[model samples]
Target: MIQASISAVPGLIVSFLILAALVAAPTALVAKARSKPWPLRTALAVYLVGIAAVTLLPGDAGLESWQCDTGMPTRLFTSVSSLLNIALFAPGALLAVFLFRRPVTVAAAFGALSGALELAQSAGHLGRSCSVTDLAANATGALLGSSAGALWIYLRRQSPGKPLRDLAWGMSLGALAVLAVGGVFESRIDRVDIVARDDQKRALAETAVQADEWITAAARGVFGSDTQVRQTATATASVTEPDEGGCRLRITATTNHGTISGSWPAKTLESARSSDVRADEGSLGAREVAAAAARLAREWFPQHAAGSVQRVRPVGHGPTTVYRVTYRRYAHGVLMPMRLDLTLTGTGRVLGFAAETVADPVLPPVTVDEAEAKALAQGAAGAPGEFRRALLLARQVRGVWRPVWLVGDGSGGRASGRDVAVDAVTGERIAGEISGAATPTAATGGPPSSR
Candidate 1:
């Protein structure tokens, strides 16, 4: 939730700015727009049209995850939020139409324009999506605004010619328009999310081995007139005996782009399938690794007999625990030996893992170095040198300072750092105890080191 909140701050700021403009610009366009009697009907009509326009625009406006792309049902959280927003405005729009009597044409025009603007913002090309759903919601909001205006008029019972009534109506219509516009830019209207910089390295590292294997296989395949991409890749990994940590399974996959491989060094057990083991002991169960290894071998070679796990052992520990496991792969009625170098969390969950073919197996344990540690940290931080200083500084103190990569002013470059903390490593700066100063202190910290 905290991560999500931090992620959403930029979107909120954008929304506020857009909303302000929407409210203010209309007042300038039609000076008397605020003065007229309530036009509830017109507002409602506009709201409907506006919503329709926002949803149907082309370009990459809609969310493109496997779920959304494959037409899976939306999650409950999304459905509830949409329904709530719509419910909030429905009654208001009806009342607005009943009391203000807005012209249908004006309402329709507003709706259409509003939807178009939202689409422009949502589609990445225009920094907006041509989102039909957004238009629908905005239209609903317009109706609500109109109804609110009508209620205000009915309660006031002012003379039809009074300047106050005209002002009230204008204000209501303008507010509705502003709200609709604000919601689009302010609340992350676009659902198409690309991976951010921080997570990219981790994702790449995790998938490198698979990519290599796939490329290698493709290349080895016979090329034909219809051949699209052609390649074979293979990597050897070491195995160890089972120990306290989860077994290690390292697979190095190579590809034309580059050779990338990951090792699952540790695993944490969130829940054990069997209660014979203490659930609190966070190491991955030997049986689980065996199961996964068997599944992989079977999936890889369905025509061959299933493989068996020979051994599992811990190699090291830190951000990710390291393990080495020896497993056998059976192919074409022959048993082929293989070793898995697995990287896992302390909790027994797999992180990065790989498997290598073993022949003449007497491979010695490889040395783990500071470079590897730094790389792990960098991956966790999303980029090198981003959280380095902060993490280094935090090492001095017992308390925690959160990591965040904020969008900096001016250049729009990302500035990554932690909240205020005692700088024990360099002793250059120390944070004094102060209540309610966490955010301010963090913000006032000097510019982050250039990455």
Candidate 2:
């Protein structure tokens, strides 16, 4: 996590510099005319501008909605990003204390500023998540900064201005204000739930060894053989029922470069970079990108090499394009639950990769035909719209992976559109919400004609 945070500093510093230059001269002139400490005041002004620039600016317009972090205060220091949040407010609070000669008030004001910034990030659609842990970290930094300023005044034999009583009052009021702001933001943004289930079927040491092997292979395959990758945190494994009478191990391991999270022993692996790598100049066509992605997928998941390319679409484009290439496996002419999705840059650098490990799934025979499944789905949705395509795919329902008919209206393509999944065996409605799997494109190939 620290490595990831360090990698982001260069970009943040560049944004800060651009905004600081615009405000510095005017701020310095205003402070100089007032016979105040211009340098410190101007520095404070520039710092505040930097805060706004990093926290309030819009980012990744493709994000769907605002998210909130409700992690405990005890977990804050474990993340280097949280530590950076504390440092973001320290200097400003220290400056405020010196200029105002009121440590308590300075601390409270800085705390309020932190709360306001968090609220703005969520409300202003800035693509930054609101975090309670950040609020706590920032307030801690303000208190530490103000205390240092007070100690300096005491050392110089100057009036250590604010009384202890003022500290109590200021903190009480600040707490109330921050709580109110947090409440408002919490109601407005989506909360992220972290579940820690105690259902480990494998030993911690065994999980660690498996994680090491996977991460080592992933780093070598995704990044390069020369790149050294080390796990930043301990690996964890939990037992999950993917089918009746069968349980799979879900393993997650974080590394200096990226994260490796998925299941094992009937495995799935999702390797994602902590930050975007610099893409090469120029763009590649969809077919070219798909070809490159197929090679990478084959290397990592050899079992899925026989799978057909379901879709190839450009998700992001600029100096280089980022393509989403999807592949689905089939067993005896019926789509298996196995899938591989690779997000690659135009130069074929793997930004993200998700693939299911191959295992001969014990699936029930598909009794329901495509026509019957589509009728059931349309009846459930109460819409007589024509389904662009109907495909037989395996879906998990009630802890069991079973064959299902995925029928879509193709109104919003694959990513944003709604689809219905009907159980191929029972002819029951499985999923009547947004489509979960990528819809096959005509350019690549359609689903099996038998469907």
Candidate 3:
């Protein structure tokens, strides 16, 4: 939640300038009409605008709508950020109540404001995420703030807050109603789930053995010959019916000194499974678990799997405490482009590992280099190209994986920009574009068959 708040600052800064310009207008009118102090009104206006800025502009506007990429919050505590969100907006709602002396009017205005903000976010206006949870959090804050302000005015032997006691009930009812409607929509959204079976042996014994050997050999290369290595335990793999994303093979296994696991589902490493893997309690904390996962990943595939741990957060999400670590993958020994995610339950128990591994990218040839490709894309679009990247990969196209030089341009396919696939052999361009941000859940799209 704190991480999310910090990210909102960039957009909030922009809105603040806008808010600053209009602050005087609101302050003059409110202070004069309500017989309030100038300093107090100015301060209140500033506070409300700041709240509006944060509430409206949360984070990057990925070229996708409803980027619930963080995955749904299963537990109640997952939404403590909602509480902070409420606090941020409360002051403004309270000020509105004081100025209007009407709880109903203030609450209605907040509802409309929240709705507009949500729409703007969805439409990719200010580079912020559109969240249903945020709307609820803002509404909850506004209702409470309005009620409190009205109550304060009433206690002062005034008629301002008299309607609030009854209005509070209406506010609660309205919130529940909105949640119910949103809940219906959310429930209708499809999800990818797995059914698991514990195996005394991995899916293919020889393949698993090869993967194990890959890890051990890489471990020796990475950690030296004297490093303590782990032996693989029989893994638990799930076979789920193919969804829109295609059939995903997920498995979790514990190793001798650590753990080894992987999933072939999402482009991001953290989103392999919806459930949590429990580890032995009172054991390894966050850093230890991350180290073990990193070591295992390095050993699993030294060249491609090399990465630096980016972010680590301890979440009380499942039965056992889990450490979710994001590792930025190194491509051609350079940082960025790819990412690996590792989640370890308590005591070094590996929960899951995910990555988009272009196992064998045959770089045919490059007729169009980076600069030329950028110019080509810009000329084709007749607009300024913001981003350009060239990488060789066996892009699965038409149920076949063919080598291509993926050239990304900021043409905003999803509005975040997408990569154009250039034929490595023919030097011709493909029709589609790969998105810049990691895809959250897979949906209907003509894709090469999933491997």
Top candidate, metric TM-score: 2
Worst 10 residues of 1 by lDDT: 267-276
Error of 3 at 357 (Å): 30
Backbone Cα, N, C clashes tallied per candidate = 73, 0, 3
Whole-model lDDT, candidate 2? 0.66
Whose lDDT is higher: candidate 1's or candidate 3's? 3
**Model 3, residue pairs in steric clash:** 61-127, 284-347, 412-415
- Every model: Cα RMSD to truth: 24.4, 18.0, 22.7
Runs in model 1 deviating more than 4 A are 1-110, 119-133, 143-325, 335-338, 341-451
Per-residue alpha-carbon lDDT of candidate 3 for residues 1-451, written as tens digits (9 for 90 to 100) = 2246467556557678788768868777877888766765676678767765665555663325544223333322245676787776677888877766777767756765665565565545455655555666767778788888878877886786457654685567557656754563366423211111112133355455655555554334333454345444434345422333323434333333334345433211222332335455747776677677677666553544543434566778444788776654323322233456666677665555555443332333445555665555555455665644444444556545455555554333222345556655565667765332233211111122211
TM, every model: 0.25, 0.44, 0.38
After superposition, the stretches of candidate 3 with alpha carbons farther than 4 Å from their true spots are 1-5, 8-18, 29-41, 57-78, 161-236, 240-451
Clashing pairs in 2: none
Candidate numbers, best lDDT first, in rank order: 2, 3, 1
Largest lDDT belongs to which candidate? 2
Report the candidate with higher TM-score, 1 versus 3.
3
Tell me the lDDT of model 1 at 341. 37
2 or 3: which has the higher TM-score?
2
